[model samples]
Target: MQQGPEGGSKHMYMEVSRQIGRMAAKGARVLEFRCVVSELYIALRTILIASVTSLRCRLQKRMLTKLLNALDAAAELSTTDRLDEVIHNMVEVGKSIGSNSSVEELLAQQNLLVRMLKKMNRLLEEEEACKASCALCSIEFLERIARYVPSSTVPIWKHMKASIINFLAWSDSRVSEHACWLVTTIIDGDWVKQWSENSLEKKKFWKNFFALLQADSLQAQRLLEEMFTFPGSVTLLFSVTDDFNVESTVAKHLCCAIRHKQLNNSNLFPLVSYFSEMVCVLKDNSENESFLCTLRRLVKAFCLATSDDQSPYFSVRNNFALTIGAVDLLRQIDELAKSGIEIYKRKRDFDNGINGGNVNPASGLKQCLVRLIANLTCEHHGNCDLARKLGAVPILLESTKLDCCNLFMTQWAIFALRSMMKEDSGCRDIISSMKPTSDVRLD
Candidate 1:
């Protein structure tokens, strides 16, 4: 295959590749196919890495894929997740293979799997066209190693982490989503967390994660609902709350709070309050809408894990945050009306430090809080119901009347309420039945 600068060789290469895949899938001599493919890859590693010919790079990709199918067949791929799917797939493989294959044989295959994943991870950087497939398959291979493998702890996946910022922006949703899961596997790994040498690797993963979350991985929006539930991840994002990279990360963390196990309300309080004090941290580039789209998932997992939460959103001591947004906005509205526009304008600025611009008084704070609530509750009727149950409906209704210094307070309220109606009929009924004032009811 490497000798091909020849014409029409492309079609032959593709056909041979397809046949190999078919054979591998059928388990027809898969072990021998894996061995031959491994030899071919080793022979052409230099060219494949250089991608001397785009066609050759593609052929190499197919070869790697064929290799993956063989491994999965050897290990079985259908079941991975409660160990979270992929890992569970591996745990089951480890269990079943113990019955069928000798310990030495499985260990040998495991070593080879790690080497392949590392090689593919490196090749992924150079192979854009097949980057997604390369990454997806590589991650699966690594997950197959049972938790005890020392190689599993190494941050061999580190090279791929740097590429994630770009992956999150790709049009291909799987690329970004798989990238997320890859980083997640790294952080959640027992070795990565337990080892002292890899502490830097763990921190780097968190930094990358929040950075992606802050930018809002649009293509991987579905992945976010399943993201950052790992404690190490949550703590790292919190420890750096003041850092700008974490701007939108806390919101992602907060929304996932429902998935947390019996969190020490004592520990959770400081974490929640710390973010509330810096609520202005979230940036516009951060779209809080991503996870609410999976409201059913959140609601399903909602009471499944109980935490002593102070609000529908966060559990904090003194419990001031339930109406946290409400209090701030009402105070601003009163002060803006009473203190006068110029004074209020002179008093505040958004994302501003000392001697900042005379930006619109509502530009950052008002817009942020309203938009945060709206997006947080958007497609999340359980949250909307929680808000109403906590008396937020009347507050949100009162908020609608405020001009918000031309920040569209009414429009935002309408958006928030409309989003609430989108997912649940019961929440919609409760909202509709309420008459905020003689002039305006939520209907």
Candidate 2:
């Protein structure tokens, strides 16, 4: 048959993919285990390469059917080593397909995904050494599927949640980590928003999700510990707590409390306690950049949480803030500011050869601290008073005049000054003294 260049390329790819599939199928039929595994790996690799080269070129329906048949045949093999090899190969292929395939294309091959999930579930039910390997691959494959076809695959994930959670309690950290990702992805991804349309269902899902988060399993706690070390993790936690639109409920409530001139939400105490624990850890390991990153995220999350005080739930927001211990947060911020200033000064002295100490300047951390202070005190008289009492006003004023201060730092310093001046004349006096000739209006 005559063909154009595009048609010729498609024909060539289909023929090659079929040939590879045939070779794999033949090897499996003849009980040549090694050959079957090798051919399957090669076939999947070839498909992956082709997909990457041409995203529009999907697996031909015939080729996909052959591959699925090969997977089914391999799953029936009684040998553990063979099963593990097959499952591992399946994982690679699934990952490649998930990454390259469009949502519509993935939906068309839903049967393939379902079969893989069923096979993995069967293996997990068998109390064998290979279960962990099988479970890991399956969890990862499912996660990939969710990422690619989130809307269509939501039901499959919801059905598999219990099993996935079981893997969270597995002794292996890697297994637990994958399970954590799967759970979080299912809840925090775009699909959850669509799935939770019914208010009752949304309430039930959140309640159950929180229960899962608060599970007593050691593995669960390990996941939380791992997440706590990262910055955006708090925002993720907050998304599940209140509305997905706001990053952190605790942060939002704290901001609301400041605005309403009240701090009394009992429900927020646990979050405050959690922050306090994080602060203690931060103090013990101030040199760790990861901890600093977490702090930066935490600060930003709080800023976002408090940014929206105009919500209809203003009274509830105030209650949340009231319980969150303003004094405790102020102390944490003060300590962070002091440490940041020390680092900033050390870097300055070293640069000028005035001190022999070598320090890595953490400008980002300092900026986060200043931004957080500004957010906390922005329109809240109570926070302004608390900040001044904690000596934040002087620190903020100093930050504005420092040679190292960037535009961001200057802007936040100006914000903090504005807030502090709202209820304290001393803050206005300090600013006026700093710039006597300039027209500095505290009002």
Candidate 3:
């Protein structure tokens, strides 16, 4: 905060404060955020009060219904251009009331959280009151509360359950995404204790959970399946880790389901699309690293199952050969590598990842694909021949070029190419046919 020994730099101090605030709200940091609720509330309230200029209003509650209407309209009272800042400040303190009762105690014993929940519940029940974006935000926000507060919000959560169920099957996965998370949190918190006597009623929650996992949307399915893999979205989702109960492994189940669907050869894309999305947004951080690590493991598991002759899934490879070959995964890899090259040409440079220059974003994807192809070709002479016939040799040779954006390209590409050529007869012929650099024509 002391800028060049000035010792009183408002800008420097404000910058530090903003960073600290962001850090507090990030991922698992929310667990400790309540510790500063009182301090934050004091500072935020002071700013809110100071920002107002003779904007005064008095509330005379004549009836219960009118008071509710007023509270609903009160949201619109803050027409300030800084409305987002004001709402954020309110939520920062209000949501904290779950972890820190001091926030409520400091404000004349008012339960603003309950009021907000009531409004959100109303918004969910009335189609006219909520937009898709508003509904999605509300669902996610409440999921955060359920995570921090746990069983304490079960009553409110149950009240909202009917409305939440309607969201589960909706075509838009964004809304159902957090609704599933909220349900998972409730389950973790043991919200079913009250309904333990009713077998049918208690099982309905799980019925809904399964329904979401098999939702038509692949994204919805991943978002929900990863919960069993990663649990809570508030904290656990951000802090991706391999430390989880494997008995609930949904990725394998989903893949197995795909195998069954492959009986009719339906929806054979597997998780490639999801992997593609992850690669597109992949970053250099522990969170993304752990997530991609798990993803690669899942893909490797599937590849291993199908490639091993003794394994039951070995036959699935034969059954879906036409479907799989038609996918042309190798060609997709070539296109992806080419896209990375184009991106590198446009940027003209590579940027450092979270831990300096130690990490590369697209390299994991390349490595994952290489491992997949390598595993698939091992001991499968037919697959190797197929790969060779599909122009794999030239692709791998091109990949050996210096591609700075995707680190270790040559090593990974060669590993797969070696696996391919070891079982195929034409790789040596292809390598020998290429002319040396000196003899090559520049034109």
**Model 2 C-alpha lDDT per residue in residues 273-321, reported as the tens digit of each score:** 4555555565565556445444444554445445566633233323334
Best by TM-score: 2
Q: What digit string (tens of lDDT, one per residue) describes model 1 on residues 65-127?
A: 455554444333322221133333334443433344444444444444455444444344443
Query: What is each predicted model's overall lDDT from 0 to 1?
Result: 0.45, 0.53, 0.47
Off by over 4 Å in 2: 1-122, 125-270, 308-362, 402-405, 425-443
Clashes of 3: 1
Per-residue lDDT for 1-443 in model 3, tens only?
33332223334445556756786667436545564554455555555543331121111112223434543653445233323433443345434444543322323222444555565555455444344555565566556555554354444555456546655644456766667655655554133334333455334544554555544445445444434332122122212222322212444454554344321122223333444443444333223544544444445445545555665445544433532432254455456445664322312223456676525432344444555566566656776777677776676666556555555555667776787678777766777788756542221
Arrange candidates by lDDT, descending: 2, 3, 1
Measured by lDDT, the strongest candidate is 2
Those runs of model 1 whose alpha carbons end farther than 4 Å from true positions after fitting are 1-105, 108-117, 129-132, 146-173, 182-224, 227-233, 240-246, 249-267, 276-443
Q: What's the count of clashing pairs in each model shown?
A: 9, 6, 1
Q: Can you give the lDDT of residue 122 in candidate 3?
A: 53
Q: lDDT value for candidate 2?
A: 0.53
